[model samples]
Target: MTATAIVLLVATALSSLVPVIVRRRLRSTLVVDAVTTAVMVGFAATAAALAADAAPARGVGVVVVACAAMIAAVGGGGYVVRLVLWAGGADTRERARDSATGDGEHVPDAESESGTEAEAGPLRGGRVIGYLERAAVAATLLAGWPEGLAVILAVKSLARYPELRAPHAGEQFIMGTFASVLWATAMAGVGFLITH
Candidate 1:
């Protein structure tokens, strides 16, 4: 248990920083985005293949399941963090815009999305794809699929899209929750099979 907690703490820290590092290192230019997108797709494919082959490994079933669970947890946590950050960021940006414009009235969230680029985020694509990608990756790893992690991260990076003109906080939260739950379910399904 202690070892697992330590491992998770480390993984969470590392996973949380992936987007930041990518953004800082790769810039948001068109060419960079294109290259990063290609790399992400390749990683997803490779990770999926690795995970599929790792399932049913003798003596490693439990380890795989544990790892998958940890991943699911971290992914879920990351989703929440992303949402909070997005909300907070939007507020700050809005305030700044209002102050600059001297428009006393606050700018609607839509104004920002419609006028400027959406902030960078790891969660993208209406939650469904994100859910499937994360869940599949977790299951793949729990099944003793080698290199599943690489592909999972790759798919996540590629599939991630930001909603610039969202209507409400509830909407975003619902999407995130759905994605997290879906992935968690996938991880559970894989665990059941591995244990059996």
Candidate 2:
């Protein structure tokens, strides 16, 4: 691989690990976020420079690998956000209980606290949904289909509207989605610069 391609690949690999490091509490979220953003911006700049130099045949392979790396980074970043929130006392169950009871007290049962058994279960399939969502975003952007992002957002919002009524769920959804989309977009932008 060319030196530029090697650097881009290494940067991408390292960016994918920032979230995991933050999740492990080896670094604070603020520091991780700044580092991640800087790394992504550097990736984009490097890709742009590579593109200007006339992409080689291997650029296609690099683009594909970079795209996949972006998706992984986005997913990992979202999980990191969840970890930070949990560490910051933003536990979903606690928020739900507090909202239901109008006070921050632990309630033993969901039904007793919220008068609804449906709310008791875990937020099912959220992790899977987040992965798929970020993948779709990266794919659409890389495919030059920016308009598709609207459809993805619309579908996600509609599907999660009911659950969003809870303050904690809403907060989690917003924060997680924002982080996921931002990472995906940055990754895709880098890929675009390299490929086109």
Candidate 3:
């Protein structure tokens, strides 16, 4: 049992680390997202399963799992955010627009769609912000300073105040932020379990 536990813990850390190296250049968008998301879920479940290990990680093991925890926070968190957005039907309208615009098919835009000019385009820098956000969240939780999470979140919201006012941006912002923060917290919990 002791050997099994150690092996599992090591495996968990390595599994989490390996997927980060996956080239996200897959041919299909759906396939790329699905694969990454699958790996993310696998890491989470693996970490959770190893929560009851007989011994906490020591030496370099702690570092490895700590890195893995961050991996889970960023990648898994993204997938969760995507799921929440999809469930909320937040982008459905944009996605379902006239597919017939190309080729021989012709479908005119409705009046509402025609006159609509984006005030400043969709929120830019979201991907970069998400990475920084996840890193900050995971680091704070791992450092045993949970209060830093609140500060980080407050800063993010305040910085994006103008963009958040855009249509659907509020929903996207809230759901994405919540998902990342929550995912980071959970993965940090797993990191804490193994590292401490």
Candidate 4:
């Protein structure tokens, strides 16, 4: 492999490890935020540097690698955001437990009003949704379709609108979506820089 490819590979590997470390360490929010920002900036800078000297023959491979790296980066980056929020006293576990019990002051059980047992837990499938969402955002941005982001957001918002009516749902949605989208954007921006 070329030196540029080797460097990119190493950088991507390290970036992928960052979120895992942060999550395990339970670092302060400020620290986690700083680390996450640094990782994204590092990826962008690396991409830009690679682009500057990339040869025509290597373009396709580099683009593929960059896209893969960006996807991994977005996934890890979202975890980093969650770690930060948890560090900042988000109480996600407690919230989950409360939601499951239908006693959460913030998340109302949909069946509770009907005098039935709480059958459903807090919204299921969020993690998969987040992965898909970030992937779509990154892919759209990298494809030179910035306008597609709005559609993605609109669709996500519309789908989550009912849940948003819950007391803390809006706050959670805003924070999670902002972090997920921002991370995806940064990753795709890096890919764009590398490809162009």
The local distance difference test score of each candidate is 0.44, 0.62, 0.63, 0.61
Residue pairs with backbone atoms closer than 3 Å in model 1 (clashes): 43-151, 51-145, 54-144, 54-145, 55-143, 124-161
Give TM-scores for every candidate, taking all chains together and pairing residue i with residue i.
0.34, 0.59, 0.71, 0.63
Better structure of 1 and 3 per TM-score: 3
Poorest stretch of ten by lDDT in candidate 3: 92-101
37 Cα displacement, candidate 2 (Å): 7.3
Mind giving the per-residue lDDT tens digits that candidate 2 earns over 20-65?
5453343233455556656655765675567556554265576565
lDDT of 1 by residue, 63-182 (tens): 654664545444443444334334545333334445656864544443234854443332233335554655565566556674776676565545442432445444454555554544
Question: Candidate 3 residues 41-159, lDDT tens each?
Answer: 56555655666664677787777777767766765665556555656765522233323343423233243357543322246666568778988999999888989988998999899
Q: List model 4 lDDT by residue over 41-102, tens digit each.
A: 67556655665576422555665656565555555565555654555445454345464567
Candidate 3, position 9, lDDT: 39
Q: How well does candidate 2 match the true structure in TM-score terms?
A: 0.59
Poorest lDDT segment (10 consecutive residues) of candidate 4: 115-124
Number of clashes found in candidate 4: 0
What CA RMSD would you report for each candidate?
12.9, 7.6, 7.1, 7.8
True-structure lDDT of candidate 2:
0.62
Between candidates 2 and 3, the one scoring higher on TM-score is 3
The TM-score measured for candidate 1 stands at 0.34
